[model samples]
Target: MAKIEFAWELGAHTGHVTTMLPVAAALKARGHEVRFLLREPHAAADLEGAAEIPREGAPIWSGPTINANPLNLGEILLNFGYHEAGPVKALIDAWREQLRASQAVIANVAPAAHLAARTLGIPSFEVSQGFHVPPPAMPAAPLRDWEPAPRARLEAADRRVLNSINQALAAFRGNPLTTIGDLFAGRSMLLTYPELDVYPERGPSDYYGITKSAEGKLVPDWPVGDGPRVFVYLYHYYKGLASLADALARQRCSTLALCRGVDSDIKGRHHGGSVYFAEEPMSVSRVLPQADIVICHASHQMTAQALLAGKPLLLLPTQLEQFLITRRVVRYGAGLGIAPEVNNPDYTSALTALAEGSEYASKAREFSDRYARHERGAALATMIARIEAALG
Candidate 1:
């Protein structure tokens, strides 16, 4: 059996790890030796069995706002140390050593890994959400709705990062990348998000759809309730969540919230109320099947789950990535987006409308049915076939 390596050097959340798990597991099940190169090993404890390549350093991007200049994408990678000759050389050496015996590498938003793989003459592919991959050609207006950065500003930024990357890549005799989008370019790309959420300029193939999180298996028993069930899943923390939780508690509906950073002291105040907080990880798959409507941070995983289950969403997105997904949900008429503020009347109004109306529910169900028509695991199968062919 051919050995395969999966590399992830970017992204700070469990989404990067979870996004790759299913394909890795499926490869193992097929009798191939699958390994991982991870930045956060502790978070990926379940992947302990796989051989590892250590990763270091922090992500460069921060905050809820995004600068959608095509060149800003390259700058983010360069700032993260990819343009440093010492670091790039060290990474190349590590990848060459680990992947020397492997047949192929599949990277998830890990540009360094892709570069290293390319340098070693090993075939590689990328897997990720659509927004992560910039389009081949920079659009006049890169970001939808938002004004584009000035051409001169974008050109200056792109030139600086591109020159640095080329200089660093030169040390290993790697081909020069012409644009930030080239970093993500490959013979094949497997997108984990739907077309509706993809950047307007991209033409990615059929999305594999959101893979079910393994945590979905270990969710605790669902709370016993007959009232309209609301499942609130956030990114561990959000601004003004206490008030939002309070609003949910007072809504006269059964609310179950799974938020990681919320302490029991805060939860205790709402203990006897209709709202329940789970300090531990809960099975979204188990709970999503029963939710009447999902309140989330517009996470693709949860949003896809809610849509797939025919449940509308009340999205409170705090960051650009989540915000983009939220906009798509609204565009599809399957959900409403709310500002990340506490006690906003719009929040309650939207929730009341979603809870009391069937139009959103019907649209969500229709979208779900359409999405479900795509073969869930076919993309992985195609990827595996390509890997096997490349090795041969």
Candidate 2:
């Protein structure tokens, strides 16, 4: 049996943790020894069966815990960039000691994980839920296709931030390349999003099209309301749904806003006739199955769960990259995409059309059926088999 070490940098949110946990559990069931290294204190609860590697001395950043809203800009940027080097290095040092006897390391997309695994001279597997990062062959692209001079300038600033991040990872790993992909030769990346869901399939050899199963934390207990109940999920640390919340309330709909932390500033904002206030984050599996429609900002967990539950979506994507991805979902008949800048005048009207429409629901249901037939367990099992073979 192979000794597998799974490492992650984020812990509070359950989406990614949940994704890798089941895989680790499956490996253990198959006679493989599994160890997990987490970088967050909040992630300890999620690491029930696995060994918990504390990050108290690690150079990891523990920024304010907030919903995945645009208001939490600092946390989002820190997450995207490995700027908090102290905590990361500390965590890596601890992991190095813990993994000294392990056969293989499964690193999440975090650049630090990659560097640590390399430093330990172990093969690393990159598991991702988002778009396959731009290969070293391609430079960072604009998040949106059509932006003016000012927006273009802003995007350039964002690119600089990412470039510095690349440089930091390279410096830490003693590599000069500006991209993470350049550092890992012969590394395999498993893309969990289904091929049919992504735009213009490039069909990369290493990209595996695996559909993840629906696993949610809370049970669905949507209150019986007078009108159509709209569920809006804001789980991102960089994007906000205040405008969408306002628009939903203005349209006279009963809205359930699922937020993560104690940010009461945006609560009680009226969209049109709809009342907007912060509600606790609910399990998409339990909530999406009962909602008439879902509104979100292109979170993979929320979007994937919504699609699986066969619920139509109204995506209000703020990031240019997210906008492009979510636009595909709308084009594919899975949902509607509302540009982040749309004002109250037009926002309510667009949302009304989506909520009243049935086409999106039909298409989402069809995709869910196809995905369910593919079976998440089989795909994960195959991945475990491959990992075992690689260890040998």
Candidate 3:
């Protein structure tokens, strides 16, 4: 059995853990041992039999959210190291010793993991949800297709970040990381999103479609009844949440709103016989099948899962990363994105379009069909073979 190390030390949220679970499970099932060096121990509780790397000091993003402006690698690296060489060095060293013995490594937004693997002369793989990168080398405009001026700004920012990465790599006598493209260049990338959603202009990678968690999490209690079942999984702390909850309450449907950090007062205001609010842990997979419509932040993981259920989404994105995904959903004709500055009426109108309309549902089903045909069993076998080759 080959040893595989998985490392992530970015956000406190569960996105990274959820994305990696299926791959790790696939590896373990093949008699390959998998271990984790997670920034948040709680994030990996669902990892089953995976062992933890006995090290500390995973970079933490204490920012309000994980989205980086302009979606550039330099901004992301700076956010993690704050332009400080010491922190960047520490970040790399933290993984170096812990991951040195592994035959291969799979990482999620952890540059340190990649750096460590390079220093040890082991192959490194990236498991991402599509938007963890900067602009590609190709000229295709990303997302909404930024104008020339804004695109220039983003390009300049990327150059600055690449310089920083090079400086860090040079400190350890490692090959200089020439650019954001160079960072991911020639590496085996495993993405969980469609090409339409990721850097479409980039070279081919293993696109495994949307993956589900190996197991479900704390699923909120489902409401009983045959009325249109609406599942509300949104950012509880968003300023627009109160108005959104109120809008849901006004709908002639049975709603279960599970939001984090929402005011109890807001829940009390909207609680009714048809609308219930519970901020408990929820198995999105289990609950998604029962949901007729899902309203949530346009996180890659949640958005992909919602599409798998063939449920149309009313995405309310709080950051650019989410906005990017939302744009693709709209292009796919599967969902709508509500602007953060939108009033209650606009938000409710979009929600109505998603719930009352059949067009979105039709597109959603098409995507669901495509998702089902991804052939996870084949993907797993292919991945194992790749891992074996990498080990060789």
Best by TM-score: 1
TM-score of every candidate: 0.85, 0.68, 0.84
User: Which consecutive 10 residues in model 2 have the weakest lDDT in total?
Assistant: 66-75
Superposition-based RMSD of candidate 1 using all C-alpha atoms, in angstroms: 3.9
lDDT of 2 by residue, 309-381 (tens): 7787888776644576587788779888767675543667667777777787898888778667656666776
Cα-based RMSD of candidate 2: 6.7
What is the C-alpha lDDT profile of model 1 across 267-299, one tens digit per residue? Answer: 888886777888666767778887898998876
Decide which is better by TM-score, 1 or 3: 1
Cα lDDT computed for each candidate against the true fold = 0.68, 0.57, 0.68
Candidate 1 segments exceeding 4 Å error: 44-72, 82-94, 138-141, 192-195, 204-206, 219-227, 340-346
Evaluation by TM-score, superior candidate among 2 and 3? 3
The alpha-carbon deviation from the true structure for residue 380 of candidate 3, after best TM-score superposition, in angstroms, is 3.8
Per candidate, the number of residue pairs that clash is 1, 21, 4
Please say which candidate is ahead in lDDT: 1 or 2: 1
Which segments of candidate 3 are over 4 A away from where they belong?
29-33, 44-68, 82-87, 134-144, 147-152, 203-205, 214-221, 224-227, 260-262, 268-272, 343-345
